[model samples]
Target: MEDRSVRRQLSLLQTSFLLIYIYRNDSCRSTQFASTEGTTSARLPPVSKFGTVKVSGNSMLPAYRDGDSLFVSWVDGASALSAVGKSIIGKAVVIEREERPGIFLVKRVKNFQDGNYWVEGDGPGSTDSRTWGWVKPDEIIGVVLFRYKKAKPLVSE
Candidate 1:
């Protein structure tokens, strides 16, 4: 766990459609001096499911922590990443890890390597895919779109 609010938030995210608000362009205020908010380039992939989870261990610290609520989105880009575009790190994913052959483990992708990915905690001393070894491409599911927690330095690069 998490608190009641986080649970409620997760329930809502699980049911509603969502989009990741990535910044693509910048806008400025005219006339009076003012600052425009960062613009978002939302080309959101279709959402199949959504939910929130409080990180339980340091395995994903710096990126996540115990009690941290994450807004996870399940999408269709499960079979491959080149098909999904961009790195899946910092994104919530439902990838298959040999740890649980039949069950789907949802976690952030973190980064990839020569067939292996380096996943760690945004918090201190968090273990991740790095601890578990390479995850097959067929395992990845989706990306995390939102989170509610204090930011911290990542334990792994």
Candidate 2:
């Protein structure tokens, strides 16, 4: 019957749309970043020295959003108090919550004074140094270098 034919066509269209959505939102896409440490090409540093982190909250909005992936370069907390860590000021960093052993947060380095780091988030509702006090040098995990934003769904409007 014609009704059955129309139903089949609609089902096929729906299936095609689903496939397109899945392809657009695929998370298994390549995550490799080429290394330029040894070459003089003046590109980004080696990907081997960086680690990826997925943002989970909106605390770092405007700069980073939830579900966004970040590439970070690891740091040595022991040397963070020295001049080596001074460069960390004004950069966004991943910090392991001092109060909560396993919790992590992304915040911008506000200041480095009195052997402590003052970090804050860009979002007004962010829970950063204002709520958690100063962040210790050893709490800093790494500095953010790049961000891979999640694909935004298309709106027909």
Candidate 3:
């Protein structure tokens, strides 16, 4: 069984029209997340909106600790992101190229060349685009809006 606490957001099922709109409009940035429903407290920020998400890995250290959830946004297109020159705001993307696959990577966008962008972790320990290579525009999932700090574990609990 999936642990409710450990498991994070669940995206909603997509309709053909929605997918069509995303492709046709070419503004397919936000991904509509399906809510679990019935659990108000568990309701996470809309996946489409630049909102907070829980971190489930340790690839990003120092800047992010294990189990430390954060907020990110799904921004697309190198041209649209040309103005962005700071750290990537919680842009966790999946690498699906022939070389990389099924990897959930989070970091900031440094430089954009051609159709790809350079991504890396803030900490030296982090292995980001430096290790993998250039990040294509389609690989980016979204930009992080914020992350709620994980609560310290109690000795008793």
Error of 2 at 49 (Å): 3.5
User: 39-142 in candidate 1: lDDT tens per residue?
Assistant: 11222233235544334444444555455566555454435565554466556554444554433344556666665555444444334454676666655544
Query: What tens digits encode model 2's per-residue C-alpha lDDT throughout 6-59?
Result: 967776676666456445434433232211111111122223445666677677
In terms of TM-score, how similar is model 2 to the real structure?
Answer: 0.62
Q: Please report, as a residue range, the 10-residue window in candidate 1 with the lowest summed lDDT.
A: 29-38
Extract clashing residue pairs from model 2.
none
Candidate 3: TM-score?
0.49
* Total backbone collisions, model 3: 22
Error of 1 at 153 (Å): 32
TM-scores for every candidate against the unseen true structure: 0.47, 0.62, 0.49
Q: Model 1 Cα displacement at 31 (Å)?
A: 49
Candidate 3 residue lDDT tens string, 1-157: 4664233212122234334544543343333321111001222223354444444445556656555656455455454454563344345432223344333555766776665777776556566666778876666656655555433332331
Best candidate, TM-score-wise? 2
Sort all candidates by lDDT, best to worst: 2, 3, 1
